[model samples]
Target: MKTIQVPTREQVNEEAQALFDQLQKRLGKVPNLYATIGYSAHALQAFLQFETSLNQGAFTGKEREAVALVVSQVNGCNYCLAAQTMAAVKRGLTQEETLLIRSGRASDQKMNTIVQLAKSIAENKGKSAQNLLAQFFEAGYSEAALIELTGLVTVRIFTNYVYALTAIPVDFPAAQPLPYALQEQPQS
Candidate 1:
């Protein structure tokens, strides 16, 4: 079987190499997933820009990480699961809280609403997300926030599919498997 190898900094074009330098400086290393995207200079820059812009938008870092955790879980992207698990912790979510979010709920009502909406959107591909959309607004998210949330989900889906396609090595520490209970938890 053919394998998609993660590109090395030296293997990419000048444009991607420059981005790799910036990523190395900023993050101490280019994550394998990002490195793989570096194989496409345009995609690497575009993804970095999109992520930067979204990070500056409506959600707090914690909230964004929460939504990412749920989407990563729903999509079964081990790369994102590992990366977002660490990011979620840095954003102040406890490991326990991360697990709960992965299961599509949270102890905090507002965050619960957010993750539930994320789960529904991911699972149903937006068609069956109406109830959760209503709940999202009722939970005090603005229409603007909804747009940002969808953007977040869309980017996550992109990366998830990248992992599915490439099977790139996860650069971050492997995320723990969800507890059996959470693994079987039914989505609301």
Candidate 2:
């Protein structure tokens, strides 16, 4: 049987190798999920470009990380949760803030709207976000910002599904369990 394995930079095509080198220089390591994507050079390049473009959109780094955290948590993707939790901290979110965002709220009203919208979209598969969308705009987000936030959510879902499909080793520190997961059960 063929076991799934994340490819090394050397195992991929020239294009993917270059992208791996870039990731190494920028992040100090090529994350396992990205390495698995390197199996298809075109996919790795496209995913990287999509992510980089979204980074230039209306959301600040902290806001983007917040969206990532909430969406990943909603999708129950441990890999993305772990990675985004670390990114959230780097973006200046404290551990408490990350936990709160994962639970679909934030202390800042504007961010609460963002997290609630992201969570609603993920939980409803984007089919039921109307109310949250209205709240998002009322919270002072522009149409352009909405587009950017949606793009952020889409990218996070892509990574989350990738982790689901591949079950690649999470290279970052594990995220703490969500509050609901930690609740003790009654004695059977």
Candidate 3:
């Protein structure tokens, strides 16, 4: 069961209410994740801010989606995986591109650079590998853009951990996990 109930548009506060209204207006419904995050107004505001900024990231639409997809895969967050996949497709990623990011291997030569860097950063928990950061910089992202990407990743971690705890039903099918593959098993 969810630790927090997913309050309907009416159940949310008049002050915290705008978040609900905005979500419904933009996404047609409040995501279960957002509803739960509404327990704290700051949490909900942070999520919305990060989401909007990341959506306007320095990378092109597809490039930003690729970064999101790679982070979702590494985090092993099925909810994020599905949500981002849907966003990626809507942003014009080919089905093949989506699969590649979900699988942690980009088939597109140009995109492989971004995917590898994003994966390395996620795996390292933001203690970014120096060489990889250099590579990401060399690939043309500015320092400011890198900061924005970190903000984006942090927001994702918030959602990913929430799902791990709640196991909430993914309202967006794009949030599913990649196909089963070699992954570390929890030790007894």
Q: Listing every candidate in turn, what is its Cα RMSD in Å to the true structure after a full C-alpha superposition?
A: 1.7, 3.1, 3.5
Q: Which one is best on TM-score?
A: 1
Model 1 lDDT per residue over 1-188, tens place: 88999988889999999999999999999999999989999998999899899999988898899888999999999999999999999888999999989988899988888888888888988654577788888988899998899889888988999999999898899888999987765679
The lDDT per prediction is 0.90, 0.88, 0.75
By summed lDDT, which 10 consecutive residues of candidate 1 come out lowest?
124-133
Question: By descending lDDT, how would the candidates be arranged?
Answer: 1, 2, 3
Model 2 residue 129 CA deviation (Å) reads: 3.8
- For each candidate, what TM-score against the reference? 0.95, 0.92, 0.84
Give one digit per residue, the lDDT tens place, for model 3 in 7-79. Answer: 6767766756888888889999888888877767778898888778777767687877787788877877887
**Number of clashing residue pairs, candidate 1:** 0
Which scores greater on TM-score, model 1 or model 3?
A: 1
- After TM-score superposition, the amount by which residue 18's alpha carbon in candidate 3 deviates from its true location, in angstroms, is 1.5
Spell out the clash pairs found in candidate 2: none
Query: How does model 2 score by TM-score?
Result: 0.92
What residue runs in model 3 are displaced by over 4 Å at the alpha carbon? 1-3, 174-188
Can you tell me which runs of candidate 1 are displaced by over 4 Å?
185-188
